[model samples]
Target: MAIGLSREQAPPQAVEHEPVRRRRRPVLVAVIVIAVVLVALFVGWIGIRAVLARQQLEAAQPSASAVVAAMRSGDVAGAKSAAESLSAHAAQAASLTGDPIWRLGEGIPLVGPNLAAVRVVASATDSVAREVVTPLVGVSATIDPRSLKPTDGRIDLARLAAAQPVVAKAQTAFHAAAAGVAGVSTASLIEPVGTAVDRLDSLFAQSSPVIDALGNSTKLLPGMLGQNGPRNILVVAQNPAELRATGGLIGSVALIHADHGALTLQAQEAGTSIGPWPTAVSDIPDATVGIYGPLVGRYLQDANYTPDFPMAATTIAAMWERAHGGTVDSVLTTDPVVLSALLKATGPVALSSGDTITSANAVPLLLSDVYARYPASSQQDAFFSSAAAAIFTKLAAGHLDSGKLLTAFSAAGTSERLRIWSAHADEQKVLATTTLAGALPVSTPQAAGIGVYLNDATGSKMDYYLGASVSAGAEVCRFDFRPTSLVRVTLTNRAPANAGTALPKYVTGGGTYGVPPGEILTRVVVYGPAGGLLAGTQLGSDPVRIVSGTDRARPVAVVPVQLKPGESKTVTVQFLNARQVGPGLNVATTPLPPNAGSTPDVGARTTVARIAHVCDSRVK
Candidate 1:
């Protein structure tokens, strides 16, 4: 067997064969180990891919479901939150699927599956955005959702549906991607879930109907018309006449409507007459006229005319004469239209001067004619006719007859007594005739010649008739008379043989005579200390002399004067017993100057006194 063993020959030892067997055994063991390792690796990869696929599928399904549910429930915020979570997971999953590790199998195992899941998440987000966001945007743009009508809601729904195509496409892609990912093994599933969640969040961000509604409602119209508001109107008128007419029209108009709201009429005559005309006409019948008195009076006072009588005559006589020739009677008789025209032109008539005409001595004759001609029934008619009769009677009398004059005087006297008695009853308590006896000092200068005189500061000349028993020779040392707010007196001295002998200066006694300081004296007249006139003055020099010894004569040259300083003298003033006068003076009062004292006594008579003066030389 050992003959010439060539290089390719066979071995002959069993030991060598054993070595080869041993080597074979080791090689086989190594192969088995490799096979096991490969098996394990395959199983692990498959398991990972399966798990990822399941996870991606699970994540996609739920996120999509959640968005759908949120949308259905109208919970845009919840839907968005869920969608964002899902999208984040989807993104993570997509990233993992695209990793080099996932590509080791050419992305066959996990990439497609994971991408599919991501697509699903994205699609869900898109769906949510379309379903909720678009409508929300529309509502925000158009109207506040809270205020939107049901119709608006329907409109918004339609808009949302119109936007659904994009979302549907996105959903389709997501489903396709998710199916792809499920078909293959993917490395990650979180990415698609994350994408869906993010999209959903975005959609929800746009769903702000409530907020939009609130914002829209904050505008002007709703707030003003709604609960809180002010109710007011500003009305104006043109002229006083128009205002009055408008007012009357309005008042009359109200009687027409039964259910009209509260109505008020006012007149503003300051500007023009046309301003209120339109409003008056519109308001109608319920308005009042704000015209002047003369106009109003023309329409109201009665009109009766006779040759000897005129009834309720106003400046009507003057107005009539001015308009036509002759007296009111002739015109009225000649043309009735003239009276009608006068009445129409003037509006309403009032009697302002009847008292004066009634006092004339011819009143009886005038009244007789009116009483005979016009038979009046009503009070107004009677008043008119009686007044007319009085006028006619006076005219017929030719002049003021004694009977008529006496009657007029009696009426006038009665009226005056009533007025004076009412006014002075209270003041009469303190004033007395004896109070006028004094050598009061005057603070202002007086006129010359009359040493001292009682003056009517009202600019009215008063007659002071002297009484009996006052002697011409007697010196008036002191004088007393009734006190009034109108009279003031001053003292002076007669000129001596020397041309420049200064007049006597008067001074007031600092006694409580009840008269206010600076008050002008009125009514009371004073002479010398005794009941006698001042002597040494001839009748020519002193035309106004106090009569004595039972003769009645008004003291002449006794005029009122303002007092001058240091012109103090004593004189006796007496109140003459004479026939009572007729209607007391109706002199108008003048306001005291600003610098006048605030003392009660000072201002008391100022209200009724016709005369007032401010001794402040500082004023021009």
Candidate 2:
């Protein structure tokens, strides 16, 4: 029929279908063009919102820091202004990220989680700025850390008490904000978005502790500083020249009495005046006696050998009570490094001997030069006592730059150069959670704890020139599916080649304790992660004798090494079968001399690199 219907005889239906097909093509093209335009508009809207939110966040981030700085400096007006700025910027950022359209984008396929994370971060940041930081700014003048400084030898505890409620409220709000930010999922996020979330989380985590410390200070300091009654605080000045697990041997001891915030130096004495007791001053823990020997309680110098500051403080307090009868309250320990830190606040202190100790010269003068300047123990002790008194005299004048003072204490606390132990159970419980307490190494779910402690066995000041460093790594390349950890400690004798003849006999030990002159003898103790076993120990490439024991359920390995002048050694301890240990390592070492250049070059160790990667894929 179609062949017959050709030329002028074409069918009517065929003619009609051609024009319809032609018309539908134009309509289809129009529909596709409209769809492309709409999609472009939608993506552009999301991009604009994200850009605005990010810009607002960038503007607001600096305000929180400014508020903290201003409040610390006791500038109420500046703090208030910063708080307002923070509120304004954070609120805008939160609004931009929380709109209906922005939330709708969070329901999209591939990029949904990224959008969701940004929104969560914005909301949490706004909540913290408005809820915690702004309210805290109101009470900033009252709880200023600078204000906590002793004015006329008395800190006004009433200020802390008055601000307690505000600080507590702020702490609660900050924790909630932190938890909220922590809940955001980083997976499936774009690189920039993931990184922003990570940095935000880190800021929250870091600031949470500061708030916690503030809360703790307001809560605990009033009672401990004797707002209601008299309290005694023992001050131990540790000398790091002769290394001990906790800084060094307690060289000088002092007692301070506090009543209604008033402080008075009750008494001061040399550590030698205290006991090498006839027996342990208190019942020493079996683990302590086994790892550190009974000398931990017998001798004041050996009290900190166990690396548990509370135990050490208790033993020292007992001995102090025995020698000078009084109720023991709390103990504070500081080393020359801490003294150097404090010196930055006190300025240069002039001694009676016409010598000056500045922050620049404090470490060398106190830890080394003092030994050389005084040949007799009595003379050295007198010099130390005089130096302590001079520093105290400067501090008592109360003319300090409050910022410098706080920085000094913060640095000391961070490095564990300064530590405190309270006799009160409640106070100790709080202190246990802080680095200031010098508690034993604590393992968390994210990190495995290991401790490398050093004690001087040479009975000399030689450790002033001894350098030490600790590096740790973990491996899961075993068949048993348990982690294997290694803690490597490098010890170097930085003494001069002629130290035997050039150094004083007292400083060199003069062959005392079977260590040759100018030689350093150190007893190294390694504490494995809790519930771990000591596989073995190595001194360089050879097996070394290790006295194995357990402390606080952690396996302990002790090794002794003696090095002559200009010598170095490495001690490695292997820990096996550690249960529930994280992929990361938390390694703590004894505080070394400020001049000790002992930081390990981890990148140079191929073994560490290989083993550190074994758990990368398997662990979370």
**How much lDDT does each candidate structure score?**
0.28, 0.83
After superposing candidate 2, which stretches have Cα over 4 Å from the reference? 1-52, 72-74, 96-108, 596-620
Pick the lDDT winner: 2
Residue 541 displacement in candidate 1 (angstroms): 99
Given candidate 2, what's the lDDT at residue 321? 93
Q: Tell me the number of clashing residue pairs for each predicted model.
A: 144, 0
Model 2 global lDDT (CA atoms, 0 to 1): 0.83
Per-residue lDDT over 66-138 for candidate 1, one digit per residue giving the tens place of the 0 to 100 score? 7557754556677667666655555444444444444444445544444444444344433333443334333
The 10-residue segment with the lowest total lDDT in model 1: 249-258
| Best candidate, TM-score | 2
Off by over 4 Å in 1: 1-21, 52-62, 88-165, 171-620
Residue 249, model 2: Cα distance from true site in angstroms:
0.5
